[model samples]
Target chain A: MDRILYGDNQFFAVNHISDAKSMEQSMKFKENDAIIATLDQAIEAGIDTFMCTTHDRIAFVCDAVRSNPEKYKDFKIYPCMPYAHKYANAVTELGIQGTIKQYVPGNFFGSMFKGGKALVSKDYLAIMELLVDAEMKMFEGVKTPVVFLQNVITDLLLGLGMDEILKGFHDYVREKYDVEPGFITMNLPKLAETLEGLGIENPIICASINSANFRMSGGKELYEETLRTKKIRVIAMQVLGGGAIPPKEALGYVCGLPNIESILFGASSKRNIDNTVSTIHEFDSK
Target chain B: MLRVALVGAGKMGLSHLSILGAHPNVEVVGVCDTSLIVMGALKKYTKFPCYKKFTKMLDQEKPDAVFVAVPTKLHYEMIKELLDRKIHVFAEKPFCLNPEQGSELARLAEEHNLVNQVGYHNKFIGTFKEVKRIIESGALGEIYHFTGEAYGPVVTKKKDSTWRSNPADGGGCLMDYASHVIDLLNHLISPVASAEGTLLKSIYSQHVDDAVYSLLKLESGETGVLSVNWSDDTYRKMSTSVSITGTEGKIISDASELKVFVKKEGALDGYTKGWNVKYVTQLTDQVDFYLRGEEYSAQIDYFVNAALKKGPNDINTFKSAARTDNAIALIKNNSKTKA
Candidate 1:
């Protein structure tokens, strides 16, 4: 058995490494030995997943995998990249590998570095081609297949010509780049319609974990509808909203959702890790 | 007296042509575009003299003003060339790829002392202006925090490889959509101190952010969340809304609807008031601001007067445009964009 990805007993914090300084702090808890010590500790405590929210956290989390390479040969790490950063296989291989996807190119409106500018044009098709090409190049030379995590916002899409534009880009990728990237739908209803329109059959999970409870209520029903028509997968994120809510509440929320394969979580301190493992254990016992 | 020519017949150009074509004071001298197909269609549709090249059109027509409605990549060169000709200009939103270009445009316009404007039509929306009025009036009382939401269906093209997705060409949902929200935030809350957010979608391309959620902190200790995206299926739910929670009351405004929710004291408990929508069209601000004398003149009389008299009726400037550019920079700086 794959062991339930989420249960009443297992829970974790959704944390991102703030800076390089925090890396030192992370080492102390896991005992300056290897990165997986922490993962091992959490796993011993019954927690199954650890979500590193930023690229900065990847190295610290990956130290375990790098040190013991084979120990975690079976484990999966989900390191959150703001966007294109995850494409850097050098750093990403150490931790986890999930395609980090974002909309805005470069930093909002700053000057571009050489070979760093985005391919832009007035013709929407031209832009779509560039995006697909980049996706192809980014995913190149990767041992582990990546599932692009798309965190979409509802308000922004409608403000622009959403349907016509997204379809144009997606179609271009499918035709030109030959990649049908996976998306984590923040808005379930919209994602289903988008998938149906494109005739695409890939997994589409709920974005982040904070809204696990919200998705459980009606999102699961919507998830079912999409799955019935197409072949999209579903998952959850922000399970604890950065540890704001207690671990149990977060665990219960993800545990409650149907067909949820993964719930991404983050941790800042050892106590958080212990609490998360304990929460997972408690949920499992119940 | 103010000779003006247009270089495109697209929807926006047509809108401008309609207004300028019939104005009593302004002369609708010429229109140009490389697309003879679109030109012929437009001429048959709207009936205006069309040219293949703007330079040829400008040289033959000798208009005092020029409107560059071409693609984003073409903007810088065209505007610079026009400004070199000592002509005034008006461009559309996502002004340039970055703030530096916007500032350069502003500086060049100033160096030439030309009237420059950008089409941020949302700003002129009556509801937002009224909300601004209410905020300025101190009715909401001590503005605290705000959340602005602008979302709609995804945008694609008939053909592939269009400029909208190009990062260098002022493409992507962030520049195309969110910049409007950022501009509005700049207007409502001056000087964004810091901004941090994540781009959520790559549905369209790897280089662009289709969906983004950002937290902005103003220099005045006010915080706001601006969520802009091109990823939703509710096509008609296309709305721009602003919610402000103040010490005394709360004010909400979207597109053309503005409302205020206030706390009632002892005497006025349970009573609801001040939900006035101010029945006015959004375009009126631009119309009235630019064409004050005439009630319903298709042409902006002020643009003509400014051209003829060489005096002043130009309401927008480069500095104001630069502020928008800078705010967009702040947004990009704090973005978590790698893989």
Candidate 2:
């Protein structure tokens, strides 16, 4: 189970619910580390998409990996590079591969870390413009994953036809540059199967792709098709299910999925990171 | 009020019937088509008398307005018969296979002072108003480029003889799909200063094209690209999206939804200071303008209104539809050379 973790208070939090903003700090501090620990604890777990909180934290994760390459050999790190200036050098220097989750909302913790330039909104028509500009500057010599963060499923619901959009963007970018950049979705209801069916063969960083609400319903054949489809790079989200379940139990549930590649964690403080590591250790022992 | 008789009791003929059926000022007493299947279907479906030959129908109905929804190759003969009868026409698109025929109908419409309209529904969609607003506002910065793309699953499932799929019947992607874009560009920009259009039969490899891509240069120094294709995969795709970037702001719409993104500046001096995103919902407005605040209906009401009011033709006239005819001509000409 090449499990990937996803929790992006530090990545691209939509601030969809009002309570999300209220619990912003504690959730960011606690749940975020739980994600990392979940990764470290599970023998099957790996890190596919990581949103670096600070330069120091990113360096710390890099250092931790560099120090114990064998210990984390199966783990592939994909650090978030949201901006062209600040994180660009850090990500390029550290040689992190994955997405540059462009946080649209200003209030998200990682938004400021986006270095004041790259935070783009869904309303902006010229999204490709920013991507092209970023590629020209920081990504000139780099060949790494650059994923876009789409916060809400509302636009996906309303007009954009989220599955079609994911496919279209993938097709457009791949055709233009022959590069495989990606986008991430979290907790979108009634879309897991559709998202899974779309022919996107890229890495998806999520928490709970197989939750009860967004479960793989229909017959066994349909369920298997949903699990094995090509376009869907399932990044299971809400693994902790809003911190309701024990982190270890959540890790086990996510790791059971045969197709899941990574789970994202939002670690705000060092204690959170340590807790995440402990959780991962516990998962590994299990 | 202009007495209208709609020929070809098919999908398009029924659409016109519904509109004329509702308009109190317009009387649609006659309908004609070769398809007894459709005619029989319409006997119960419509309240109009159906006939086979248009000449006998024309003689009997003596309609002042006739809408031709027959096959493409037959459009010229049917429209010419109506023009000879001094009847105003509302012809379905591909005004007639090539520009020469389109030019002929346009001249006749002009000569008879008849209000002729063609079926190009996108021009009547609600988003064009927003497009026009954005263009006039000069918000999208210096408008250097505009592109429109419309596509759907290629109708490979259809039999080989579907008029929409046969070159003799004006079947192909360029004439069927890209023609909308060409007419729209001509409507929005200046009459397409110069254009280079290409049609590809790569995806389906049938006698007809599965895709068409056209590059155009407008007189305004703006370059435009239009894509028309039958995207044959699992997903069905049909869209007409427009993007215009000007000196100050941008206007982009898929017609399904219209949005204009503008750049705002400094607040009141010593009073306020901030910037904000402005969301302009222009789709509803466009619908109101296009349908004259009535529900989205056929262009015949407007045409009849224009005729009765002796006003401008709200529907696409033979002149406007001729642009598509010209573009189709270019695509066919290019396809032959490439072959």
Query: How do the residues A49-147 of candidate 2 rate in per-residue lDDT, one tens digit apiece?
Result: 443322223444555556676775544443333332233322222211112233222333253334533223331223433444443233222333443
Q: Each prediction's TM-score against the native?
A: 0.49, 0.50
Q: Give the distance in Å from residue A45's predicted Cα in candidate 1 to where it truly belongs.
A: 70
Q: A1-286 in candidate 1: lDDT tens per residue? A: 1222322111121122111223344344433333445457656656554433233334554555556656655554432223322332212122111111233243422332234343242323443444444433332332222234334222123112144544555455456534444454445545556556657556444454443232221244554454455545555555664334567887876665555555544454468766765675566557
Query: Can you tell me which runs of candidate 2 are displaced by over 4 Å?
Result: A1-286, B154-159, B197-199, B232-237, B264-282, B285-298, B335-339
Candidate 1 stretches greater than 4 Å from native: A1-286, B43-47, B156-160, B263-316, B337-339
Who wins the TM-score comparison? 2
Report lDDT (CA) for all predictions. 0.54, 0.54
In angstroms, give how far residue B288 of model 2 lies from its true place.
11
Output the lDDT of residue B149, model 1.
78
lDDT score at residue B287, model 2, on the 0-100 scale: 16
Cα lDDT of model 1 by residue, B1-339, tens digit: 567788755545654654565454567678887643345444443445668788888788888887666655677788888889889887766677667877888899888878787666555555666667667766666788998878765453222244666677777777777777777776765656777765556665666777768888888888988888765543223456678888877877765445667564431233265443322331132231111111222124444556566456433344565677777777787775553
